[model samples]
Target: STQNANETQAVVASVLGLSANKIACKVKRLGGGFGGKESRTIPLACITSIASYHTKRPVRCMLDRNEDMAISGQRNPFMGKWKVGLDENNKLVALDTELYLNAGWSSDLSVAVMERALGHIDNVYYIPNVRAVGRCCRTNIHSNTAFRGFGGPQANVIAETYMTEIAERIGMTQEQFREMNFYKEGQTTHFDQELKDWHLPKGYFQLKEKSNFDARKAAIEEFNKQSKWRKRGISLIPTKYGISFTALHLNQAGAMIHIYHDGSVLLSHGGVEMGQGLHTKMIQVCAEGLQIPLDMIHIVETSTDKVANASPTAASASSDMNGMAVKNACDQINERLEPYRAKGLPWKEIVHHAYFDRVNLSANGFYKVPDLGYKWGENKGQLFFYFTMGAAVSEVEVDLLTGSHTVIRSDVNMDLGRSINPSIDIGQIEGAFIQGMGWSTTEESLYFPNGRLFTQGPGNYKIPGFQCIPQEFNISFFEDVTHESVKTVYKSKGVGEPPLFLGTSVYFAIRNALWYARQE
Candidate 1:
């Protein structure tokens, strides 16, 4: 059970000139993936397998921190240029953008990543007559691969930047501009898929009210007028992220489960536990499906033998896919014991009787996301199962002397449908927000002229520290709303990647604060 364990097994088998079944891959857990381990782990496994095949002895390969940074890929660096035509009411009439992405050395996952970026160009808005093109430029540096949010965050940043600039140019608030262009139900995306159960507007107003955005803006303006060295600004941003693997076949997952005569259960799924609470959620899923105590279920380590041809656990869909698979497997076992339960037998007795009756107590479950199709040339058909929506309001104060800023406060309202675990979902929302803030403000990957990465270690690479956090952080989830189009396990939506886009508000807020300092 390795991260991207299925692909790693295949690659290793091919490298060793053996069948995939002959090789064994097992991983207990990953420290952190953040989309880095999805493909980057494959080469390491392949190289070690090759060495073992030739030497007829076990071999291993592991990269040091500096080597990993220098050799492994980073997120694709993009330079985007766009032109927009708007009506008098600030509604978008046309949008044409070209994105040049530095693919760096080789095309690892850049092609798929670029396709996602192009599809997400509109973000939460309805933009008709849109023409977005992505060009992957080959560079001399290490090949850039996937990161968290895949390419959705980069695409959303492009649209959000344009919205901010257009709002400033037209003398309207960014909030107003965003609201006017919000996607409504029945409206189609640029790719020709209908937007159903649109939640952007509702989420926007909820965040606006919760953050006291209008009053804070007025107060900041007044404070700026009185202060000489400090200025403050606030912004609200919305996100509508589509949930599914753009590649349709990669949307499927497999799970296996077994029940012991002692009433204990074992669960295995294709998803890796990267500290995102996937295993915890899986346990809850099994407990709920089997009506068993949480302590009775144990999640085993990931193994290619247990779940073959498994999809990588990125895209925030791990819970939706793997959790459903686990539930399905549990349901199968429960079905076999339903008659015993109907007879009013005890759970322990049911298990005891199940073994005596030769009733199968083991099951294999599989799930594939439905209705995902896309024609790249035409950009038509449904590429997503459903959309996850959220919004955030960020207030910031900028220093006039140094180009530094601090988040004064932040308010977030996200729709997680019916959350399976509120605590874990909230943690993901907050962590993604802070990581997005780091990407937008502090994390910059620098390189020398000779294509050497200069920011090789943590000392030079600035991540958002404790000090960068907002003094007043308020986070809440929308209540009583379920996704209309997609039926997930427990009616829950993906919470991993969508909230990262909410941090875009921080960037626009800092931009607004800079406007005042420039006027002075």
Candidate 2:
């Protein structure tokens, strides 16, 4: 488990100036981080380690909620300027964007965040002549760090904003414009990654039919016309998120599996469980690989001693890489137990024999995502192992008098190839979309003149609650998912950070209602 995969490296190499092995960071659990703990949390540990080193004794340092909020990083606020060129048929011909990200006070992870933003500038569309320039501006506040979706959410907002403007400028419905401009199966992205197993439009159209979007759009229009101070709107938005680290070295993972004499198993992997069910998935992966019942395998804690030099649990690739490593470890154990099974021995008897035979009951496994990463300078290699694709149809009703709004309904369709657990995957889809919705709509951060955060706690700031959820929400998976793009773990795609951008549909739908209101 990791917030900073390099925390030990940072403290060892930089703070104490000691060997990497001199320090070990142990992670027991993370309730919820949302990228807040990715890199910015390094400073906390570094400072504490320094205090302990100098004092020659144990030291504990903790901050209250106010102190944490006042000093810690926030999401990078962005300002973007763009120009889009569309052909006579409204097909995207070219797009040029200048994105300025506020990297408050320190650089932190701003560069990597900006790169993900630049890579995502096209979102789910294909623009032939697209050029994106990103600037990480220095500001006078606590350094902004990774939030959920990293830089992709900011980029999606810019792309969708211009897309909505273009649709209205040409007197076309938002749904029709977005559908017509989607990338076909053979299209390659601006960054040169080929769109294999392209299912963005597949899920998009299916969601359209399942949600009855066409009829609802017309019905909303009639309702808006009859109402005086309230207007209704509907929109369809799609997401295509790359599912690996942009940094090549972070693409590897390690797992350690120990089979005891009693045939019970202890599995340790290089992934943090932050209320996301990562440990549960790894247990399943281990159980499947070992061909045993789920109850026989128990996942130990995530610690540096268990799996050294592990990657951060961010990037949504923890499962993709860690699950593979667990599988490899299980395979090693199975191979050792093969002879016993050939002799018609049961699992417990095989384990007992293997323990007595000294057949290496403990296995260390490692895996590196093959053919991964992109060169920022060349901009021509694969940025991801594969892409996680999904689409959403959201309908919003906005109050003209008070500027309040309600989400009438939302429909989401995703291409999660052979979901390891449909219940968990759907929960992730729901949680991520709601979090993204909060970012785009009600969740606003304020600042004082001297660079102090005004919205430090829930009292001043707002997050989505039960009342803000859609009145009707539907979720469906693409039945014809193919893993030809990249053979991920269990032929399943990453779901943690991809469905987040689909929440922008609510924002776009609200914009549509506001657009119609402006006409009056």
Candidate 3:
């Protein structure tokens, strides 16, 4: 495990016949990237830059299907054995897991990924005597990189699978088992982090009620009991996603806000958009902060030259960090306008008056969460932030003889911590859930013997189709849950990666359906 990112840069330079200084790499958004855009992109970019520099021409190289799949990284495939011990009421007591990650070639982000896996090994449950050890097994395949959920979904899947197995062993339904073990208020997790206001179980229970989880489970069981060729299954899945970058220092964020005389706003931050609507959400944040129309705010492209000394945009912390920074800037302007507001003028008029006063209407705000004490030798984990949970239930029908399955209906209830735009947030949740479903069920990657990927392009690989999406898709947010925002307009957490694990429920539902098929 070599420390520092520059080492990776140096290795890329040596392989590609370029000096490290000449690399001039730029970070940007990648559409539909499966963790391949992280450290794994350095080698390809270095090669391209070297080709361009030596030839003194516009040399362009792009990977075709096989080459791209071989060269590009993947979401690490993990094999873990978990034994969860629950008490009489299904309260989680202890958990032990052995995690083996297929960290192909050079370790890359494997250490961080595996550590994260171990860190979140218990998912949302409060389990004692939790023992999780991870080994990054070096293989001759392409290296794995960070996906949307990072290693969180993988680790959580293991825990949730344990939930399913335990439920089966105890002759209980999956929902009952999950509800019994869900994180309760004032409980300390395996990492010794005491959940100050943990509401995962409350949120999950609300979701269960809304999604008719009990009704669905009963129906599925009855259907499976009657059918010989087909079966049904349901699951209540929850996600307790930690919001900060695990590497402590990378958790800070900076933002620039410029408000013009006409009351228009220009916003710049480190986070990039990969069609996930990060930009749209940022605009909403700025608008809410300034108490102005959403149209008044404009988001600019993220650039190092503009927002200098910025952290890499990952970990679902962009909104939490940058949105707070923008709010800080807005507060500054609002403070200056307060005098005019004291004159009994409307806020807009106050803003207009302040603008004409030749107000120095530009600001840069920074945010680093305070009192987050993390020491290397402490052997303890205290969160700079806590996780928000969501529950998803998928009902699936499997054709036993054909070995095929269809998702007949799906229901989702997410606690996204005070959604700014309920409609937009729902769409995001639905999209991520669908994408994750594809990852588990439809999308599969292929690699050559020499560690090159074969399924590289859209032509070769297949994701989910419209037909595959459940017809009876239903979603709702938990009510009365305020965005406990300490720094921003509303205390809203990132809604990006958490819902991706909803696919786990879908996959397990399929598994349960298939189990019923096996009995038949």
Per TM-score, the best of the predicted structures is 1
**Which residue pairs show backbone clashes in model 1?**
1-26, 1-27, 1-302
Q: Write the per-residue lDDT of candidate 2 for residues 221-279, one digit (tens) a residue.
A: 89988998999988888888988888899899999999989999999998888888899
Model 3: per-residue Cα lDDT at residue 398: 80
lDDT of 1 at 107: 97
Worst ten-residue run, lDDT, model 1?
A: 477-486
> All models: lDDT?
0.88, 0.87, 0.74
As for TM-score, the candidate ahead, 1 or 3, is 1
Clashing pairs for model 2 are: none
TM-score against truth, every candidate? 0.97, 0.97, 0.88
Candidate 3 or 1, higher lDDT: 1
**Candidate 2 segments whose C-alpha is farther than 4 A from its true place:** 54-57
Model 3: C-alpha RMSD to truth? 4.0
How would you order the candidates by lDDT, starting with the best? 1, 2, 3
After TM-score superposition, the amount by which residue 52's alpha carbon in candidate 2 deviates from its true location, in angstroms, is 3.4
> Model 1 Cα displacement at 321 (Å)?
0.7
